[model samples]
Target chain A: MKKEQMTPTPLVQAIGLGSAKAGFSHWWLQRLTAIFLIPLGLWFVFSLAGVPDYSAATIQAWLRSGLNAFWLGLFAVTALLHARLGIEVVVEDYVHTRWLEVLIKTLLSLAMASAIALAVFSILSLVRGA
Target chain B: MSQPQTSSRPLSPHLQVYKPQITSTLSILHRLTGLWLAVAAAVLVLWLYGLAFDASLFQALTGFFSGLFGKVLLFSWVLAFNYHLCNGIRHLFWDAGKGFELPKVYRSGYLVLAASLILSVLVWLGSL
Candidate 1:
């Protein structure tokens, strides 16, 4: 037989085409962040609810407290991560056009990175500015 | 390779074909609220940035939120946040291999909805 006929085509499903090895980490990290956010989220809600005012001084002082600053910062970071992961899945599910999906995902990554960066910076500034 | 014609082939599951169930509706709501929360979180980060960099900006943002429209939006965010949170916990339970029974699933669905409502009310009330 000729060389073209000798080798059979590879099985697509068997090779798992369209599989990104990154899925498990994405899923696992999403869950892990969710777990962390449970306490962080609750603490944030209750603490903010209890705040007497949203005035600059009051908000600043509240965040300036060591534990509050620590937890809020942690919460911000974790929740941002979780949100990015969730958004990625949403895009993957609904975005059918390959290029548009790619573009959106790329933009999402950039935006999420900036958001996380600004969140950290803002939190730090709050604590330090206090 | 030649492409196989698929015009006559049976298509995959579409939203129009399936009757909506509590489980499916809630699942979609979880995703929808998750997206809303992501947007809410970005706004929150922006609020933090305002507070950190410029107190006047923060005050302006706060002023806007004190309005009626803002109040509605803020309340919706609180409800969305609570809904996502409670439903997320339900998802975690399923991940743990529990709460798979149909009756249990329906019970938990209602429970999540009630908890979300109560939590949102308590939060708004507590803030007031």
Candidate 2:
């Protein structure tokens, strides 16, 4: 007896044939951000943990150091990026309404943008010895 | 017309049907850590904003954070940090298209748990 073979659909041929294809970009971004944060997050925690108290000037002093500032900026950016990606996945998975999903995604994007802006501003201020 | 698949009021897998696994604990811990970090970040924002505003406000805020409750919060922060960091590294490996086999998955899961706990303890001991 001869067996029939499976064939790809026209739509599948037009666009790559798989569920894993589309979501991979988002997955990679999330992983990239996570990888970036591994060491930077550790540095942030260790650097801040040593401070005797959370005094304003002490915090400023910590941020003032070049190494600390570098890691702080890295952490800031990676964290905002990671949070946005994670939240986006959650919304995409759970939020079914088209309008609601769009709204949530937009809000998350804005939040991430705001976080980066604030972080950059603070980093610049510290760098300028403000 | 054909009938729809998976539309017979299909039964879904439930917890009781399967034995518990180590990765399940790690998954739950990841969510819990995410939550604790959110709380810590909120407190951190309050501190940063207070410092940005005025010295008096900063003093009031710092006083609270340095207090007993604050210490507890920071402890949890470190715990969450360690857990998330180690588990996140595991996630990174998965993202790289590795560690799909059963033994490797369980092994790495246990390693992540052990490392986070050890690191958290060391940090706590060092801080004291």
Candidate 3:
């Protein structure tokens, strides 16, 4: 066989493929946080529904309980993280421009982070009777 | 590979061409509900902050949330939240490489919708 014929074809030339591996972790984390949110979210909703009064004192007292506070914090973190992941997928699917996509993702990340921090801080404050 | 030219390329099927099906409809709803839930989460944080910060502010927020418009919004939020949760479970099943059959997919889609509506109603009634 001639030298050119004997040489193996480049994989990209033969297969015409490119990397599509970046989104697996994002997808997996979305599912993971989603699983965590199931029970936590159900519990939170039921508890909130059972609250007879929407008064601040009542809500604060509910949050002051260690278990409630802990679960609330966990729910907030998991939920916001899950939301960010989901939003990221939506943005990726719809937003075609690279710069625009990056901008939206950054804004979403910052917003989710701020929401999580505010939720956790509020929970802690309530637990401390602040 | 060379990229296709933007102007002459055929576009993918979207709402205009495609007939609406349960699976596609649910998928869109899932994204929308997820978006709404993010906003709801931010509002929740605000409410918590109000509760923690000042009684007056908390009361005002609570009053607003208890009003008719607020009640409607909360009801919709509850429905959206449950729908998203149920559909997330369905997606997890798909991730596990199960329930891809057409019948199963349609069944699960309807199940999620019904469960979400029923749960939302129960929660709303319980709160009343």
Candidate 4:
């Protein structure tokens, strides 16, 4: 009796069948955020460096400024997103246990969410002078 | 804890004794970059927290960051960030089962180095 050969799906594709494609989306998002951050990150470093006597007022004013806010917010959000994705990869690669992986991934997501919230809150405080 | 007994002879570790391969170099560099990123993130979190705090703290941090040592650390972070980001993407391709050929391995290695240099120069110029 000849049994038909069945092809095993690639690991990359296998992720989606059980995991709802979240892993792939996260990986892709990390790359996308990295692409977005490169120029913005450079601009931010330069912008901060050129400022004179970077006091609290000066820093607040910069964050409050429309130009600075846009870049800062983007960087903050994208950085957290990318970090979450990166950390998730590290966790998945090294943390072999099923429950541990899920726990770590969940914790990472929560941390990223908190960081973004803190960043936005901080920026808002700066903008509002509070 | 029992340490593994070694033969009563001098022995070199794999890295010290073997000719370096791309995969080995890439693995070591990846871990190094990861450690660098961890340190960089700590610095960044402090900076952000400083921003949230009152003016004196912000000024203090800014002053320190403008100093020579601060600049060097910042430069190192920049290099590590660029290198890791580039190499991580390369890993993604490998994960997808692409670029396993010898030629592509060398090509991507050079690409990572070149891209890091260009980005670093652009960053320095922007800073100045």
Candidate 5:
């Protein structure tokens, strides 16, 4: 046999096994947003503690302030993103069935998206002094 | 890897026969608390929506949260949040290729537990 014909193909190449490239981005973003959340979460807890009243007007006023509204928006967005990523990891690990996994993941993405949208709208309304 | 014989045999260390260790327990709790926090975030969105929309609805929701059951639920939720945060930091350390030693792992686990409890108590008191 010719030399080129005698070479054996690597098993992985022959079998066409390829990397999924899923976990790295999810893992990195989860950690990055987690780092963001540490300070943001603390700020949120402290800000809530500082709220002297839970009345609607009071909360609206608090949220209306430019700085508070800005941070709240950041917090809401970062938190939802982080949460969606974390839950995706759990689902990937535990949901063994492919269709069920896809279904659950889609539902989760929709829920998170809606939550982020509603939160941002609420913040905007508050900022608009509505 | 080869497919082993499919026979009726007690598989390796099934949950029923396994004694719980702190590491495994904490790991499980991490996932559970993460799930709980996701639900809590949804509730938060509702509260924000209420605040922006209706006064009476906001009042009712606030009142509910201020009641006895709500206080207990909030406290537990806070605890879960703290625990998850602390353990998440520990996990990040592991991801960086550190803290894999057995003693250090257990030590960090206990530290996370204790810090979570203490921080939760402090936060609740501060809120009150």
Candidate 6:
């Protein structure tokens, strides 16, 4: 009895009738992006605040800096990704209308995809052109 | 296969049935701020287009943001961002299995609110 108590029993394998989706991955990626965005986002706000003016050249020159460009670009990409994931959950949870859910989510994905692509392009253009 | 003739499962009452508490309010606010922030973030990225190929668009956005309506939106965005950030950190701590005690939960909730307000003020001042 003592030996049996000392030895750990194998845990029961669990099963469920849950939706067959990558729920864990979706949750984890949201957290990962959130963690990444914290510093990247803070830097962005501060950097923009520090700018002398709101001129394009000033903005362009700032983007010319290697660190600035890198962090800003990372922030753009990470933020959009996080936003995409966050909105998906919101739609899934609240939008009970099946067709509406699918339609909104599809449109959202397209917009986010194009936005991300444009963000990367803008960052590259700014840094290299500068 | 046949289903049960009568529904035996109990259904939870709608949110309106319960009195609002700090926990429920804050929980909903987190989601609200999160959704609102998503919209703002999308526009911010879209604004980045002004940086690359659309000078006129950039100028227009800049002007629009400097206007009263823009200021209102920006102010709310800052508040939302700060609240979401602080509350998110609180959530992360909870995920790590700490602060589950009732008193601790209430204390942390207040702290999140205060911190969000302070951070929002600071950002607004700094950016001015």
Each candidate's lDDT (Cα)?
0.87, 0.74, 0.85, 0.72, 0.86, 0.84
Segments of candidate 5 deviating more than 4 angstroms: A1-16, B1-11
**Lowest-scoring 10 consecutive residues by lDDT in candidate 6 chain B?**
B1-10
Candidate 3 per-residue lDDT over residues B24-127, each given as its tens digit: 88999998998999888888888888888766777787898889998888888898999999999999999899999999999999999999988998888888
What are the per-model C-alpha RMSD values against the true structure? 5.0, 4.7, 4.8, 7.5, 5.6, 6.8
Residue A30 of candidate 4: its Cα lDDT? 71
- How close is every model to the real structure, measured as TM-score? 0.88, 0.79, 0.88, 0.70, 0.87, 0.85
Candidates ranked by lDDT: 1, 5, 3, 6, 2, 4
Model 3 TM-score (2 dp): 0.88
Highest DockQ against the true fold, candidate: 3
- List candidate 3 stretches off by more than 4 Å: A1-22, B1-7, B54-56
**Full ranking by TM-score:** 3, 1, 5, 6, 2, 4
Which residue pairs in model 5 clash with each other? Answer: none
lDDT of 5 by residue, B1-128 (tens): 22224467566769887899999999999999999988888888989888888677777879999999987877778888899889989998998999999999999999999999998877877777
| Candidate 4 per-residue C-alpha lDDT over B11-127 given as tens digits, one digit per residue, 9 for 90 to 100 | 556556788877678777876776677566645655776687655666677788789998788888888877877787787788789999989999998898788778777767765
Question: All models, DockQ values?
Answer: 0.52, 0.33, 0.56, 0.24, 0.40, 0.38
Kindly provide the TM-score of model 2 when superposed on the true structure, using C-alpha atoms: 0.79
Give Cα distance to truth, residue B110, candidate 4, Å. Answer: 1.8
TM-score of 4: 0.70
Q: Considering just chain B, what TM-score does every model have?
A: 0.87, 0.78, 0.89, 0.81, 0.88, 0.89
Model 1: lDDT equals: 0.87
Off by over 4 Å in 4: A1-20, A49-53, A97-103, B1-19, B27-35, B38-42, B55-60, B63-69, B85-101
Query: Residue by residue across A1-130, what tens digits does model 6's lDDT show?
Result: 6775763322212234455478989998999998887788777766776787778888888888768888887898898898999899999988877789999999999998998898989888877883
Predicted complex 1: CAPRI docking category: medium
Compute the TM-score of each model's chain A versus the native chain A and list the values: 0.84, 0.81, 0.83, 0.78, 0.83, 0.82
